[model samples]
Target: MLIQYRRDIADLQQRIRNRRLQTFGLFGTPIALVATVAAGVGSKVVFWLHTEMPNPIVNTFTASAFILIAASVVQFWAEIGGEVWDDSGTSVRDLKLDLALAEERHILEARRHTAPTADRQASYKERLPPEIVRLRMESRHYRRLHLLMQWLLFISSAAISAVTAWYDPPQPAKGVLIGLGFTVTVITAATGYFKPRERAFNLQQTADAIEQHATAIELGIAPYNAPEEARNLELFATTVEGMRADQRMREQQLDQPQQGQQQVI
Candidate 1:
């Protein structure tokens, strides 16, 4: 049952991964196109509604605003895709770290009685140097890019708003202009708040697990050679198996109702 459950969970995870890739593959292009159109529309609107401003100034503001919005849209799409990629990267890293730690623990089990387990630990050395390095490089690179894009979005928005306020002044149409600015600001802030938190939370969970394992080992309660430690590993394995089983059950329940509803319809 545990084996079957693990298989099911693995299958579900693969499906989720594939679905995300497919979504980015299909929807990302359309999103970019839509953003391009949106930027063009914004430019046209500025040209039509705020005609009193000098041609060069208005054109400059329109260009800046549209470029900002279009860049934001592209950045936003990339951010979404980056989030999924980050999660996948973190998952892979966690798996590698866990496997390396587990192997270390396995070696310790075979040498608990020895005065030093260094010789036994030879087989348990880090196998994730390349994987870890690659992930770190990509992670840092993405973060730097994200920060730069964020500053660009902010500067562009502020420049556009400033130009709008100065040129358009407090006319009746000013209300409409301010409203658009406010709405975009609010939406951007709301998404920004949640997306970063979600990524941080996933990374934290893995870090916590690694810390827990280290602490247990340091206390000698989780020595690889001890019967108690082996029992603990068994229990931990069982718990993981149970979680996979529960996930499978949940998926089954979810699919069953959906299938039934579809059949009825």
Candidate 2:
């Protein structure tokens, strides 16, 4: 039964991965973003000159540009209008529920099998508290967003610098330069003010601490070495809750602006 559940979970994971690839395609989003920007520039140039030239200057983008054009068509077609993540007219929700159910079944089976053993380490590992799970999930989410924004900030700043020297005779287009400047400013401000990295770090730290306590409890180590099994579990649970509360307090502190002591220069 455990093996069957494991296989089911793996199959569901593969299905979800395949669905994501079909929905977004590999390297599709970044390619689409670039293609969109290029199309904007090309369309603007064509509109200003009012001339449509036929012939490929370079066929480098031809293979990749199909994804962008197809996206527009897909969006415009009412009969097949599904956004990258809408999951409309699909079994995405059902698949997710099935995956969760399979995972739960596997854990239950494993725990049942290991209950009589002197060391039920695997059971304890699989029984992580909900707060720890949530913390880890949120940590990764914030870290992902934080890194993406930082990269955007860096790229936009670099692009602005490059654009300043791009045009012939070193005279960049005023409007384009202004637009790039705005983009860099927005990215910089967002990353600087929001501080997703700090939030992720705190959450990860709290989760790690909670997991450590849980491990000690499972191993019959100090603090969790109390004679009663229930007492050890209770102590571990209480410690996890305390860490979770501390994590929340840290997040709230991150949201509030820091006040520096007065400095006389």
Candidate 3:
């Protein structure tokens, strides 16, 4: 059952990732391209209208330009409002909790399976720490990804700014660069605002706390130094429950809506 739960959570995460990619492919890239093209052609279009075009065609050209700009603005607003990558009616935090519950169930099963004999206690002892280790590793993975995205955005922004300043690009190219910069800024700001780094840190901290409690119980140390093996096992179970509760609280806090910002739902 725990394995099935893990698989389900993995599937859900993958679906979310794929949906985000699809959103980018269908809406993000095309809208950005349209905006860039409009920017690059804007100066020439204006020049042609004022100096080269016949007066009779000016109204039609102006109307077309206006429509393109208006459409681009609407697309940009939609992206900002999260219409492009909405989670398709699932709570990410709830999915994570479900995964955690699955892990807990697996641990309990391991304990029960090994409970019949003294010699088999080793199997039960070996069960939970590995799950904590996996959680820590997952947290580290997210931390690394968040850092990589931050660096990439920083480098891209700096490179774009430097090239524009040093090369003194034409007016149309300048407009395109400005649009690209705006897109990059939006991406960076969104990434930072979501705070993947903080999420990773919180996950790691919870794993560490759980692992410490488990270790103390295993070693027959303070707070878990119950005389009977059964009592110690009970302490271990309750410790895990308490740790999970703490973790859930932290996740709930993370999921809370920021002031003045309604949840996307």
Candidate 4:
């Protein structure tokens, strides 16, 4: 029933990210970056001209560069922002409603549990199964490793894209560009084969499952509300292991070919 709301939330998050990037580009990229780059590059070009042809007047070229840079700076500040009030369908105000919907969904889930007190919950965590503790630690390690590798890949790829975009034909940066392009390609291929991101997500999902079950046990939620504590622990552990088994299956799916990845996970 809530799948549509989840999809809406995901879409909203993506749109929000894209909108923020666009806003940053409009605010900072055009005027400020151009002004800054022009000021530095113009001086270098003028110096090169003087070195190659002493007949050219360096002072005139320098003055023109300064004026051009100043103009860019002035123009940058003049048109820095767009309309203050947005009336679009996808405005930020509308996007935030997804968050409210998510909170409502959570409230519905929470209603299933017995009224759990903070103190009791903390005590319950203390008596959590040792196996879960180990699983949680393992999940954290996998999650952190994946996070680091993903950032490295993303940063490297984005750097290559920016460099490639800026590079023109017949330039000295050809060798550097080739090296970076090759490195990014190799890293991308390795990442895709190994599936570090998917592994991390699977591990994290398992961790969340464990935590949710633990919460149910702590709060005396259904099934965990059994009369015998031993039976409840047995059920909890069984449920957690089943969740981990599902996680392992997902990891195996990641190893399969792209065509196989289309099947429901």
Candidate 5:
């Protein structure tokens, strides 16, 4: 179970890194290009505007350049807003809890191996609830964070692309504009390839299933309500194991790469 938790944490961290990279690429590159263009040609353009007679071509280029710059600025702002919402600390704390639970599980395993005693087995059982709780909580945290990132990436890409198209930058900045388009395309593709929303939904569903089974067992409800306490405990263990197995299957399916596309991480 701790091994599974570690995998989950690693997956979440990878997704976070991907999202940050997307945000940086989408926002930073365009801003830098715009700044470079402005620095290199700004004074000359301003002088031309003030001194030279305005021609249709010059007027069109000037308007297009300013519009492209404005669009880039807006795109940068949107990306920044998304980054602010991406609070990775929440997931980091969850990972810390998972590590602590893993350590406790290791200690219990060692004790049981050393003693092979009923008391040690009982101690191990006593530690199960907290470990399960930690797993469920971590899953839930990962789900929420991933969901947030998915939407952020989707909306930011869409908005930026639309703004870029509307601006339709002049020929001089065409390369930069093309680069922005490519960046948005990559970000969108990454979001779909990752399927963050699907991961979140699957994880949340698994967490809920685990919680329901655990709760039913604790309450001694049907399937776990037995005259023999030992039998009831056995059923509880079996149910939990089944739940974990199902979750692992779901995760495995998720881990499989999409057809014609390699896994990103």
Candidate 6:
């Protein structure tokens, strides 16, 4: 049963990843079209600003590289965020479960135990392996990094856009062209970063829920229910068992005597 749970969790993670990638792929074309049209319009305006009327070649080609680079960053963000929001739906459920467990634990402790506090404390004493703890820390680090990088891209694009918008760029036509390009960059960045980070939030919520459940169970307050959020419960269980096994092996070795006999003087 535990093995099956492990498999289920692995499968869920894979599904989420695949869905995110698929969404990004599907969105690529539309994003490309928007970028292309914006570039075309900017080019025409630049031409008109330089001459009495629009010159498509000078404006179009010059702005093409900037627009393309901006578009690439836009696409990168969309691809990264794809389908990550699906986990948000379960956030309420997990939070509710934690609250319910805490309430149940309190009532049970008051009715049956003189000191439920000790039990709760003991439950948390079951320390996770050093490696698992490290992994969890690393996961948080990566999440922060992802968010930071996205924001940096957004701010840079906005600054460039503002510069382009403010400068007359030879005449009104060139100014308009640069302004539009920057405007699109701002919009793309806003969409990518401000969008809900449901997946990461859900995972954190689930981890918290699991901890609460474990505590409640130890206090004899309520039954524990492992969340299927990230399917990490089984991994948690497996890690615990492995740690125990290592301890037992170490104990056995300590109890055994040295195999070789020493020579008498």
TM-score against truth, every candidate: 0.29, 0.48, 0.49, 0.42, 0.46, 0.28
Report the C-alpha lDDT of model 1 over 132-181, residue by residue, as the tens digit.
34434544554554565566557657766776777656475566566657
lDDT of each: 0.51, 0.70, 0.68, 0.66, 0.63, 0.51
lDDT of 5 at 21: 65
Superposition TM-score, candidate 5 onto the true structure = 0.46
lDDT per residue, candidate 2, 9-70, as tens digits? 99988877765665454246556858666875686586645764344532434544666667
Clashing pairs in 3: none
Worst ten in a row by lDDT for model 2 = 256-265
Steric clash count of candidate 5: 0
Candidate 3 lDDT score at position 207: 90
TM-score-based ranking: 3, 2, 5, 4, 1, 6
Most lDDT-accurate candidate: 2
Candidate 3 has its poorest 10 consecutive residues by lDDT at: 256-265
Model 2 stretches with alpha carbons more than 4 Å out:
1-128, 168-172, 260-265
Clashing pairs in 2: none
The predicted structure with the larger TM-score, 2 or 3, is 3
Candidate 4 lDDT tens digits, 1-265: 4566567667667767765655554455456645655655675686664555343444555565666566545544443543432322244556567667775875676566445454444444565566566766776776676677667778777876777778765276677777777877877787778777667667767777777888898899987998877677667767766787887788778888888877744
Off by over 4 Å in 3: 1-126, 169-172, 260-265
Error of 3 at 170 (Å): 5.7
Q: How badly does each model clash, as a count of residue pairs?
A: 2, 0, 0, 0, 0, 4
The candidate scoring highest on TM-score is 3
Better of 1 and 2 by lDDT: 2
Error of 1 at 140 (Å): 6.3
Local distance difference test, candidate 4 = 0.66
